[model samples]
Target: MKTAEEKKTRNTKHQKAVLELLKNATKALTADEIREKLADNINKTTVYRMLDRFVEAGKIHFVTGQNGKSFYALCKSCKEEPPKHIHNHLHFQCEICGKVECLPETLKVPQLDNYTIRETQLLLIGTCKRCMNSTN
Candidate 1:
């Protein structure tokens, strides 16, 4: 017997919580990780739907892990008002801990003779500093 407005409001609350979680995350998180961190214990379907909505809104982006798992992270280059998605930096994945993070350094796209480059996805895989330091 819940009204449409009530359902929409609930969805909005969940969306906000997801956004806040991603905003505070240092590394990209998987859907399972996100679900575990949420206080409300949202269902898997609802969590995925929320993530899809955020991706469509351009408020966040996904990086594919080595095992084909997708990790979601906040869009640092996206504008708040219009939510334009612009990714110029590369993604780094730590082999030891399996954490993915966006690198702050932008790539210097090299010019080709004639080919036009519309987009690029560069993922660097190696042991992250935290793992390297821990092993030493």
Candidate 2:
């Protein structure tokens, strides 16, 4: 019988591979895209499970596109101590190519009376420069 720590560490290869994929990706990648880039023969379900674990661990963040597709990207502000992460930035989704990218700008959360905000996600949808240039 393996200890919980051993169990978590044992199945870390897949998680490490997925984290490397996200770290190298310039834009957010979907699970299918990640699977296509992985060297190992990993299944879609496994990829999704790994992604879910990463999200819980604050190693990555995800955005749902306007087309209903979810893309994952690394969370640079993730801290291992408290297992917390900050994702207070805007996400841009290209309408034409369906690609999602993180905006460099940060969002300001407004203060409300007697209201508490847990999490916020700002998604801006439009044609990306690549798509715009190609059309022009």
Candidate 3:
């Protein structure tokens, strides 16, 4: 495990670029999409490492798409000190545009009688407002 100081030192320019891309994105992006948006100098392996680092730092989070592809996005309320990963909202995927985004509302997980809910991931599929508006 790397120390906090080491993690801080590992934040290179390429990592900053990757974070910038996700920060400006309106929706979550896949690994391939992130690599494609980055400079040619950064390779696939390096991109994955950077992503893992960011995830460990609680700077980003990912949700699995319908196709089982992981889409990464910036964490809205994650902490970097102890690294807290808390996502209480659901994910929305626009079927028409093929874009995946995190919804703004908070999700309420149901209470079960005996079942324990460790993790929850919900993906709602339908046409987004942009696609709906474009039709009329």
The best candidate in terms of lDDT? 1
Q: Give lDDT tens digits, candidate 2, residues 15-82.
A: 88788889888999999999999887878898898888787777788888887878899987544422
Q: How well does candidate 2 score on lDDT at residue 15?
A: 82
- Residue range 1-136, candidate 3, lDDT tens digits: 9898775665576788899999999899999999899875567888888888887677887888878888999986544342224566889988888899998877776778997654457789899999999998
Q: How displaced is residue 131 in candidate 1, in Å?
A: 0.6
Q: Model 1: per-residue lDDT, tens digit, 7-116?
A: 89988888899999999999999999999999887888999998988877778878788989889999876553333234668899999999999998887767688876
Candidate 2, residue 49: how far the Cα is off, in Å? 1.3
- Model 2 lDDT, full chain set: 0.81
Q: Flag clash pairs in model 3.
A: none
Native-referenced Cα lDDT, model 1: 0.84
Task: Give the runs in model 3 whose Cα sits over 4 Å from its true position.
Answer: 1-11, 79-84, 109-119
Cα-based lDDT for every prediction:
0.84, 0.81, 0.81
Higher-lDDT candidate of 1 and 2: 1
Give the better candidate number (1 or 3) by lDDT.
1
Which one wins by TM-score: 2 or 3?
2
By summed lDDT, the worst window of 10 consecutive residues in model 3 runs over 77-86
